[model samples]
Target: MSVTLARELACARSRLFGLRGVTIEQGRILLGALEACPRWRERPGIGELRIFRSAAGHEVLLVPSTGRVQIRVAYVVPPIERFDAAAGVLVELARLGRAARRAG
Candidate 1:
């Protein structure tokens, strides 16, 4: 049930990404950046849907990009009750990307 909801959220966010020309591969990059957030981690576990909103109000969505046997989550070990933490990580990831853009 929880996984189902997460998937739905990911799907919704994916649609928003379409408007930005974001693709699954792009999502992977964003996800990688997100994992760099302070105190985050992902181990081989169950699948999950990572959700967030970009500063521009675009949804930053993510789904575990690995198989159940090789589950990919985030840098922070997810607390079952603290799922929202993932969103914050996404914001941080996006921020890093934007900063890099400015620097470049």
Candidate 2:
């Protein structure tokens, strides 16, 4: 599963609807952060859905699939562009993951 997840993450494409705002590079980076984070928990009421909430109140939803996982990022305070907001979330999540690993 991890292998498949890794592959999917590597090739994942992120976009808000059909708008070409979020690039594949951004998606790959965000997905890697999700995989590295320890705060993620399987969301209740969904078998394959996982969610991660950053300390900054950004909620990231991930639905894993064999072909392609759908990733959605929601901001408590919406940004000008959804694509522009993912980098901040990714950085925070990655920092959290690093802290958790160090503490453990």
Candidate 3:
């Protein structure tokens, strides 16, 4: 399941965000962040996903759940293009996660 999820995430990053390549280390880091969330299993719908700019100018991916808040990704760059790309990847992740949860 992890293998398939990784592949899907990679494809989404490349195709949707126009990322040339997502290194294994980055993928692992992102997946690790997601796994660390206590409410990771309670997949939030894409509409519920929130993107916000941090005070340090990073793009943050926030997933709101019942009792806990899940922050999925944080892109360091502040450029609009980077933020758009990060948001796109995040939205795709939420969509995939939601579908997987429903299927299961």
- In TM-score terms, which candidate is top? 2
- Candidate number with the higher lDDT (2 or 3): 2
Ranked by lDDT from best down, the candidates are 2, 1, 3
What's the CA error at residue 30 for candidate 2, in Å? 12
Residue 88 displacement (Å), model 1: 0.8
TM-score of each: 0.31, 0.40, 0.27
lDDT of 3 by residue, 1-104 (tens): 13221211332232223222334443434444455444334333467554433333333344333212222233444334544545554565455445555544
How displaced is residue 26 in candidate 1, in Å? 5.8
Model 2 misses residue 100 by how many Å?
Answer: 1.0
Q: Point out where model 2 deviates above 4 Å.
A: 1-45, 53-57, 62-71, 75-80
For candidate 1, give the lDDT of residue 52.
48
Clashing pairs in 1: 40-75, 40-76, 41-74, 41-75, 41-76
Give the higher-TM-score candidate: 1 or 3: 1
TM-score of 2: 0.40
CA lDDT, every prediction?
Answer: 0.39, 0.44, 0.39
Per-residue alpha-carbon lDDT of candidate 1 for residues 3-101, written as tens digits (9 for 90 to 100): 211322232232211112344554555566545643334334324766543333334445635311111233233334224444443345557656544
Relative to the unseen true structure, what is the C-alpha lDDT of residue 23 in candidate 2, on a scale of 0 to 100?
Answer: 40
Q: List the residue pairs that clash in candidate 2.
A: none
